[model samples]
Target: MSHSSSDDEDTDISESEISEYEDKKYGELRNGVQNVKTSNENGTFICPYCPRKRKQDYLYKELLQHASGVGQSSSKKRKARDKANHLALVKYLEKDLMDVDVPAKDSKPTDESDPSVNSHEQFVWPWIGIVVNIPTRRTVDGRCFGESGSRLRDEYRSRGFNPVRVNGLWNHRGHSGTALVEFSKDWQGLQNALEFERAYELDHHGKKDWFANSEQKSGLYGWVARADDYKMNNIYGEHLQTMGDVQTISELIEEEARRQDKLVSNLTNIIEVKNQHLKEIEMRCHETTHKMDLVMMEKDKLVEAYNAATKKIQSTAMDMLKKISIDHEKLKLELESQKNELELRKIELENREAHNESERNRLEQEIRENAMKNTSLHMATLEHKKADENVMKLAEDQRRQKEQLHAKILHLQKQLDMKQELELEIQRLKGSLNVLKYMENDDDGADVLKKVDSLQKDLRDKEESLEDLGELNQTLITKERLSNDELQEARQALINGVKKLSSLGNIRLKRMGELDTRPFFEAIKKRHKQKEVEDRVLEMCSLWEEHLTNPDWHPFKVIMAEGKEKEIIDDDDEKLKKLKKEWGEGPYKAVVQALLEINEYNPSGRYVTTIVWNYKEGRRATLKEGVQLLLNQWKKMKKVSS
Candidate 1:
């Protein structure tokens, strides 16, 4: 019967709890006491169950009601939410663990007594375990011992774990060399360390054991509560250890609270002392305020005095301004008069400037013309000097040739006289030889034979000498013929040079005449008929022909003529056809024939005579116009070709 009642009571309580949960709104429970005011400047009452405050104006009963209602509702909702989240996390962890494929050997159970294996499957408090190998001698110094612990702590942290404590154990013997490290309670950090270990194993596959047998070992090992430990220990061992640590932490917190209370008491004493100092300062400030009032009174009196002085000075300045205004008016009138005079002077200066500019332009044109004339004269002078030098050189050559010829003639005459004397001696010897032959019949025949032998030998020697002389004379004659040819050539060259000089001189004189007659021809153009105009044009054409035909004409003129011919032939073929149309084919053909004949004599003469005749009246202007006409005709032909 008692068991039945207990079961009924449990049923009743469960029904009541279910009813309460159903009746309460989830949004209201989560938000908590929406209508209750929590902020006020007045003294406040702090809620014990949560971090909520209310003004003192709130009734004690209302405050209690809020605490019992909304506070309980929030707590219950939070517990339910936390339970659901925990279940979800557990399911996720199970899925991850099942998916992971750990090696059979690595997953095998380790020794139960090994402290390196973490027995706890879930962490209630933040605590990680780590073991590190540290040489005993290195831990002899306190700093080295700290460094070893720090190194172990850093190794865990480097793998994304937060170490809370690092403890190093050292001994005199080298055998006891170990460090312990604790990390913050973070499941992600634990998972990362496990993942790192797994990756390290895979990366070093087929090699020596990465964790235990490496020559350059990291000397580190980490264990976390979330890690799957192969060894089994007492299931509640970590809970008991955590409880004990919590008890020790509570004691430490109480001690710290007592120390904080002592610090608060000390601060209160300091505050009280500072309050007394503040009171003294306030008293001094009041005294200073009283003195400031007196100073303000004095400042007001001085300001009134200053205002009076300012008023007097302002009056004086007003008088001075009036005088200055009058002076300004007078000065403005004077400036106006001066401006008027300046404008007149400027106009006069402008007129003078215009005259000066025109004069300068005229002077510059005259200077340019003079410079051209001077250049032509200088070239002509150079040609004259060259001609004189050539003439002197030719005369020297002629004189030398005449001297050589005279010497040769004298040598030949001497040779002829010697030959005559030898011939006469030969005749006399022959006569004596005949006389000796007659004597040979008488008894002196041997003597006569000896004499005749000597005479014959002498004749042979003489005849050999004569043969040598004859060869020499033949060579001399050949040399004389060569000299005569060379001399004739020199004389011809001299004559040609003389003719060239005379022609250049004639061209210069003719050019001067053209310059002199240019204005006269321009003046006569008004009254001249086409025939007269044609005659004048012919005269000009003849002058140009003579100039172009002269071999010694100025090099510049020759170049100009060659350029004109090339420009016409290459650029103005159509202009030649146009002339055929205007002047008739017969006259055009005649003109062309004349031009070709002139070109044969001197290449520069082509088109020279025509250009001179066409441009004689207008001189430079007509020449430019004719050139433009030719260029236009060439352009039209090019367009047609395209």
Candidate 2:
């Protein structure tokens, strides 16, 4: 709870009235009271809990005084609700500015603690008034406003103001129209000098009447401001901290005087605002009084109008009452006559109703008898119709079945004739085919299955025999000795290629050399002469020399026994690995070297063209086929856990 208005007023704060303030407490200052926000529009410390008001600009000490005074107030003051808030404010200031001590409200502390009554007010015994807009020119002497101080004093005296000192200061370099009039400690001259402000608005112009050139229509050419808008001078307009005081005797005194004068001027402005507000309220009150008088006059006229209307209504009502009485008597006579006629009509209606009821009962009895006869007749006709429909439906069903049976017999006969024709065609084809001539009768699809099984079994046997024969040839070739020189050269080349391949890790690749099985196998199988194989390979190398280096030509791929990718398998490399296992590494290396040279010579085969070939089927190998081979190998691996 706090007192929050546009400003901190000089009036007493009660607990109830202060509690009505906005919820801005010290704890809810800028960020939080813990970190006090000590800035206001004037770049000075402020009370966050108070809605800022003019003349409330405080030096840190003054604000501390306000907080501590309210926070530690006695019970009679009834400022209890704001005790915690003011206490927080004190803490906020202490924690931030590190100042000490606060004076009680309306009480005087030592001159040092109270900056208003500090050295300036105690030492400086003169009241200053600033006057402007005096006549001065470059032609005039350097004297203040080109006039002597005594002459200026004489002018102000004639105007009802006396000053102890009058000094004119330079505006720039030449004489200025401004002078500082210092009055004695007595209030007489000070009050008169201030009257320039009261009589007419005095400002920088310093003229009673302001003018376009001389400045007409302003009090003392607008210089009537009390010591430059000061009425009763107090503290300076801002904190003494901003005055650049060095705590020296003269500077401190001056700082204190400026601050005191500022306070006085601020307080005067506050009073003026309040006075203006009071005047406005009075004006509003007067307007309201006048409006009330108008309303009272209108009320009198409305009362007179109402009385006239009442008399007119009374006369019209009396005439209406007489007419109503005459009509009432006439209506009573007509009513009595009508009642006699109505009794006769009622007797006549009762006799007619009794006759009609008897006639209605007789007609209803006839209707019931006729309805029973009609119901019996309807049921008999329905039964007859149902029996006739049943007979027709049964006859129709028999006719439909007879027609269906005849059509079925015709379809069966046609099927039998087609079967006979098919048998004749089969006999003719069987007679013409030599393979079917030995076939037996009573055969079904099982016989066809039997023939296919026999063929597959024979093919499997051939493949197994071929594999075995190849192994036998490899063993025989390995048993024979190789020419030492040729063998050494081939082995050396193979060693170099392997060394290069091993040096480049999996991440980097450089491929060389090729392996061909046909020439090598032919030498082993047909000639069993290593020399023939080597010599023929040499001829093949020279033959395809141009094709090997051509980039556009790719007849063979660079393959290895194993690769990092799952599907990257070379059939030739697989065969070479097998051959090494069989005929030994020496012979396999020789064959691979000879093929590599031949492949190098082939221009069209310069670019790698991979194949999954069985020499009879030298089709280029596809990624799909390689992937399938990898999948098959994966499926065949033993299900073993490591």
User: How does each model score on TM-score?
Assistant: 0.18, 0.18
Tell me how candidate 1 scores on lDDT: 0.46
Model 2 per-residue lDDT tens digits across residues 119-160: 333222234555555576564554443666678788767877
User: Candidate 2: deviation at residue 95, Å?
Assistant: 13
Model 2 poorest ten-residue lDDT run: 237-246
Q: Over 4 Å off in model 2, which ranges?
A: 1-246, 323-642
| RMSD to the hidden true structure, all candidates | 58.9, 51.2
